[model samples]
Target: MPTPTEIRLKRAERLLEVAFDDGSRFRLPAEYLRVESPSAEVQGHGPGQKVLVSGRREVGILRLEPVGHYAIRIAFDDLHDSGIYSWDYLHRLGTEQAERWAAYEQALAEKGLSRDPPRRRGG
Candidate 1:
């Protein structure tokens, strides 16, 4: 497996650029990362329990924390920071962006969810 040589978070664009040692590079959106998070909250404890996260089109990454030598913890602006994105997983996400995103959108549509966050009343 190719290891990541650099990871750049473009705050303005809400994009995460990952470059691997094998000359393969990918630019992933923050919304994609958040919805497809590898955390239990998103992936669930076992098979067939994955949560379809929605309303994150405007979500931005707050910070990236190193998790030892294998992964980094992404703290999203929405306050989700539990997912520890490993090198392998990030690569997988980058490579599988299209299929995964399509699936996510389909799932959301099936459940009647929107990419836009719900509007507030008083605030």
Candidate 2:
């Protein structure tokens, strides 16, 4: 398992860049992280109780609060400030981004949901 050495938020790109001591780097999109948060509100108290969060297409990072040396708390512009994103958790999320995103997309598809609003061209 890789340990994070530093974390930087690129506000303009809406991405969180994490550098691990093992020379690994992950650039996670803010929207992705916000939707996949590990908070109880999203994960619930059991295995099959995870909530599918929608309407996060416009969510942005409001703040990143360090929790000692192990974790950091992310505050979203949508008022989701409960999830404490630990280094290990963040690493896992980064590592599993593709698979997780696929699953999320699949779930959304099954539920007739979309990640973003429809785009209008030349408007």
Candidate 3:
């Protein structure tokens, strides 16, 4: 796995900038990360059991913690902290961002959902 040489969280831009040892750099949006979280809660128990996470267009990373030597635990602003993203998974998310994002959008559309959650009228 290509280890990250640099990792920066651009709070204002809601982006996580990661530069790998292989000279590859990725600027991943917080919303994308939130929706594509690798947690069992999101990814499910096995293949084809994946859940489509919607209403995450405005989600952001609240913090990140190292998990031993293999992955990082991401705490999202929405209180989701189960996903431990490994180097390999992060790399794949970056490299295949376009395709993944497109599929997400399609899934949401098919389910009559949107990136933004429906707002409650009274609370």
Clash count list over all predictions: 0, 0, 0
Once superposed on the true structure, which residue ranges of model 1 sit more than 4 Å away at CA? Answer: none
Q: Candidate 3 — worst ten consecutive residues by lDDT sum?
A: 114-123
Candidate 3 lDDT, tens digit per residue, 1-123?
899888899888988999999999999999999888999999999998888988888888899999988789889899999999899999999999999999999999999999996688987
- Ranked by lDDT, the better of candidates 2 and 3 is 3
Candidate 2 error regions (>4 Å): 117-123
Worst 10 residues of 2 by lDDT: 114-123
Q: Which candidate do you rate higher for TM-score, 2 or 3?
A: 3
Query: Against the true structure, what is each candidate's TM-score?
Result: 0.97, 0.91, 0.96
Q: Residue 82 lDDT in model 1?
A: 99
lDDT of 1 at 80: 98
TM-score of 3: 0.96
Cα lDDT for residue 10, candidate 3: 88
Query: Which candidate should be chosen as best, given lDDT against the real structure?
Result: 1
What's model 2's TM-score? Answer: 0.91
Q: Of the candidates shown, which would achieve the greatest TM-score relative to the real structure?
A: 1
The C-alpha lDDT values of all candidates are 0.95, 0.89, 0.91
Candidate 2 residue-wise lDDT, 35-87, digit = tens = 88989999999999999987677778989999998899999888899999988
Stronger candidate by lDDT (1 vs 2): 1
